[model samples]
Target: MAFDYDQYIRGGKLPHIWCPGCTYGIVFKSILRVVDTLKLNRDDIAMVSGIGCASRLPGYVDFNTLHTTHGRALPFATGIKLSKPDKHVLVVSGDGDATAIGGNHFIHACRRNIDITMLVFNNFIYGMTGGQHSPTTPSGHLASTMPYGNVDPSFNIPELAKGAGASFVARGTAYHAAGLDKLISGAVQHKGFSVVEIINACPTTHGRRNKFKSPTDMLLWMKDTFLPAVAFDKLPAEKTAGKFPMGVLFKKEGAPEYCETYYGLVERLKKQREGRA
Candidate 1:
């Protein structure tokens, strides 16, 4: 017997938009693992997404979902978290959508420390609306927007989240299937803002443009580049150049959730209106 994803899968859309060997499907499976491990009710969870290849994830999963404007997933998910306060909200988005176009919301979402889980699929290039130079697109990386090679440095997403007041932050590459499942599960279980940035491979645009002839080659590149916790601590300054590591970059407690603050304001207003009346 085989594990039939049809149990939770939203059928009738027989074909998916993702290219063959694209890593988004793999990431989706990991998310499903988290959803399954928690044994959560589909009615209690909301999967929100913005306009991108990754954004299409919500359409395939059986849950309360929203397909919002580009770069607005964080705010929309924030609204869901603040209003419902008890629902499990997750945002599935791409690097550009999460970090570039939605960078403002991303920053404030972390500052708010809302009880929502954000999974950023970082393939380095903007694959959905064409291969553009996204905020996380590495320095010297080639893209449609940066044909000559990108000059700006890339963002360290998990580290940025930690600095911006996110309660939990973790990095997981597409190659680390089981590792991602564990990290995502832990993040969803956490009570405050959590970000799981998955470094994935874009076989169509990034792969073809970057000159990788096959999918496995891109996976090898990821394997060669990724480092686990404390793996880069011993590396000297120059040796660490252009290197990117992935893992539970940082996490801590004591940050107040945004819903708690919102409810406090609501109660305060109610008492104020009563006194005036």
Candidate 2:
């Protein structure tokens, strides 16, 4: 049976701003599928996003949503999670919005092991902002700011998240729609900070500049390049070159979630005050 996307989408929010052949829509639908599979109530879900093409996603969803300032989605979502710990908080961000200006917050959120799911849409270029180079932009990639080809090193998002202490870290590509749904569902169901970096294509801004003839070419590249985690591990290093592992790249079970610890302390303090009274 076809999933009823209309139930989750906000009314009159269609005619999405994404360009033709953009894979952000695929990522969005994957998220909706995860929500549906979990049987999550829209009222109990808080979706937050910062300024960027990917950040516009929250506006189209019927869940409690916050469109925040550029690179500040994590901070806003952190607040929401801390205040209403029972609510499921999810943050959507672009590569730049998650790693460049928001780098500090991103690392700290992982360090805290907060119970928030962060979905990073990495198209390599700043699609909404004139194809500027982002932190995840591959070295030697051409962008508006790097018309001569970028020399800066790109971030390995999964490694960064795992190193910073995220309890769950995963990677998925828009090309692997079904696998993406599983990755997202796992991330959402995880107990602590979860980061899922979705590799998608921005045909209009990034693809044309990179000489990708069409969006299909970009997706096909992803299909050929990304391997499932177990398969990636079994391959020889030489064969794995230029290829990345999809699925859950890292997961640290039994880590302490931030809100639980914080609220526990608050309850203990209240108990102490009651004892004095």
Candidate 3:
């Protein structure tokens, strides 16, 4: 029997507004599957997002959701996590929203190792803002702002998250739907900061400009380019240079969670004050 997806989505928000061929829907479904498999209570989950195409997800999902300012999703989610450490907080953001505008927040969140799961929809271009060149747009890619071809280098999101001290780091693509669900589940279960970057295609913008005749072509590219970590590890450097490896990339245990540490410090300060009095 097929699972009822409507249980998680808002009844009034049927027929989402994403463009045809956009793979954000696939990633969203993966998230729902993870939620179902984990059996997490909807009331205990808080979904937050910054302004962008991907940011609209929280509005459509039935949960405690926050649509925050551009580049500020992480900080807002941080406050939520700090206040109610028992609640699970999730952030959904696009490449531009996460890496370009919210870059500082993203890194800092990782540094603190706060318990929040962030899923970045990396479609290479800024799909919401007229397909401009985003921080993750590949070099030589075409965008509305870079009609002549993108000259700026793109960011390797997984590496950045690991460097910033994220306890869990993983990569998934929309084409690999099952893999995305697994990665998202792992990220959510982790006790510290976790980042899962899902590679998707902005068919309307990135595809047309890049000569991908259709959105399916872009997805096929993802299916071919991204490989399982074990298989990817066997390839030569030149052969694997541009390919993305799927599955968990990094995970560290025993790091003290930020909110727990903060609360402990508060308790210590209170005790000291009481002793002095």
Candidate 4:
């Protein structure tokens, strides 16, 4: 039986903006699968996204969605998660929106261990506003801004998340759409800040500029390049030089969650004031 993805989409919002062969739809379907599996109420969930191709996702979803300003999704999600701590807040952003313009927020959100799930759709270029060299654009890739190939080193998003103190850090590719359901589900279930980086292909912009044969070719490259975390661990440095590790890369237990700590402080202060009275 085919899962009706249209059920989760906003009514009358059909004909999405993403181009043919773009993997955003695939990644989104996986996320929706998880939402269905968990049986979460739409009212109890909130989705936030910054400006970008992937960020347009919130506008199509049925949840309480906030389409925030450029590179500011995490801060908006932080406020939502803090104020309505009971709600499950999810942040969807592109590579540039999440790691470049919003880099500071990305790191600090992890450092604070806020209870929000951040899903970064990493297509390696700035898709929406024009194909520019993004923070995660591979060194040799060409973009509109980088006609002669990109020189800026790409970021390892999962590693960055781990370094910034995210308790749960995972990587999944659009080529492995089924696997993403599990990864996204796990991220949402985690207690502290969780980052799930989805490596998707942007064929319309990035692919044309970079001379990729087709969107299919780009996706095949991702499937061939990235290795599962367990297999990646066994390979030596030289063999795994440019390989990305799929699956959960890092996880740590027992760090104070940001909203919980803030509320605890408030309770303590309230108790002290009551004692004085």
lDDT values, one for every candidate: 0.87, 0.95, 0.93, 0.92
Task: Return the clash pairs for model 2, or none.
Answer: none
Ranking of all candidate structures by their lDDT, best first: 2, 3, 4, 1
Candidate 2 lDDT, tens digit per residue, 30-65? 999999999999899999999999999999999999
- What C-alpha lDDT does candidate 3 achieve relative to the native structure? 0.93
Tens-place lDDT digits, model 4, residues 75-114: 9999899999989999999999999999999999999999
Residue pairs clashing in model 4 are none
Output the better candidate (3/4) by lDDT.
3
Among these predictions, the greatest lDDT belongs to 2
- List TM-scores for all candidates, in order: 0.92, 0.98, 0.96, 0.97
4-25, model 1: which lDDT tens digit per residue? 6777788786478998878888
lDDT, candidate 4, equals: 0.92
- Candidate 3: misplaced stretches above 4 Å? 270-277
Tens-place lDDT digits, model 3, residues 148-260: 99999889999999999999999999999878888999999999999999999999989999989999899999989999988999999999987878889999988888998
What lDDT is obtained when candidate 2 is compared to the true structure?
0.95
In model 4, the runs with Cα more than 4 Å from the true position are none
Q: For each predicted model, how many residue pairs clash, with residues at least 3 apart or on different chains? A: 0, 0, 0, 0
